[model samples]
Target: MENQVTQLLKAMVKPDYTACSYAFMQDGKIVCADAIGVIDKINNQPITTDCTFNVCSISKIYCTVCVMQLVDEGLIQLEDKVA
Candidate 1:
């Protein structure tokens, strides 16, 4: 079942988004958790579980705050390329 979940994540990559992380639960417990695809096309870094993603509208605030903090620090610029 874990292998199937992993394969699905791999198959779902590209064409739309380059990478995704997934967790499948069974009976209120996590049965499978993993990530697939390169972090970006340029660096080709593998997406790790430690990385955070704003996957839905409910997550926008957290991502927005992180981005805004980066902007304030000038670590990320308006001209920066985002993946």
Candidate 2:
């Protein structure tokens, strides 16, 4: 199952999707970590496991964590009006 996913990712490489990273975590630990693509466009480098990808959007779970943190700090009330 894991190898199939890895192979599929490798076969789907493109200039637009030049950088991609995948982490398979199970029971709170990463079981498999794989990355493919370019490290830098200027040098036309290939992306490797060590290369970092930028995550631009906040996921729903991340938003929930931020809300919980704000609640813990008493910065906002649950019933407070959102701006």
Candidate 3:
């Protein structure tokens, strides 16, 4: 799973300024985690798990989709409080 994640991230990497990181959790634990590309072009530094991204509005899209999926599956209600 870790190898697959690394390969996927490598394929997703683009341009000189872009990097991709992915982490998959199962049974309340991370099963695969990876970082690819460089965050700093000047120093040729590699991206790490510690790196923070200014995701802008991208997270909103993901959250909305996930919530809607749960709603459609009857797993959650829109008015339900997140406990």
Candidate 4:
């Protein structure tokens, strides 16, 4: 499975794609983690699993989870406006 994933990632990076970092977890423990390609095209710095990316949509999921947790704790109501 890991080899297949690595091969797939290698195939992906061959085109216009810049880089990728992925991790699979089971029971809160990471089963596999992989990173590929350069961090910057100019300098050709390699990226690692620890490197941060500006993942835009993922923040929405995190915000939703936080709001749901607040609702569960009776700290906020669903009808409340967030501003």
In candidate 3, what are the lDDT values of residues 16-45, reduced to their tens digit?
A: 546888888999998878799998888888
Clashing pairs in 2: 37-47
Better model by lDDT: candidate 1 vs candidate 3 = 3
TM-score of each: 0.54, 0.61, 0.69, 0.67
Candidate 3: C-alpha lDDT: 0.86
Those runs of model 2 whose alpha carbons end farther than 4 Å from true positions after fitting are: 58-83
CA lDDT of every candidate: 0.81, 0.80, 0.86, 0.88
Better of 1 and 4 by TM-score: 4
User: Tens digits of per-residue lDDT for model 1 on 27-64?
Assistant: 99987788888777688778887778766885788888
lDDT of 1 at 25: 84
Cα lDDT tens digits, model 4, 31-65, are 99889898888888888989989989999999999
Count of backbone collisions in candidate 1: 0
Tell me how candidate 2 scores on lDDT: 0.80
Count the clashes in each prediction.
0, 1, 0, 0
Which parts of model 3 have CA positions greater than 4 angstroms off?
A: 15-17, 73-83
Give the lowest summed-lDDT range of ten residues in model 2.
Answer: 51-60
Candidate 2: tens digits of C-alpha lDDT, residues 1-83: 66877788889977777777788899999888887778788898877777765665657778889998999999987888888
| Model 4 vs. true fold: TM | 0.67
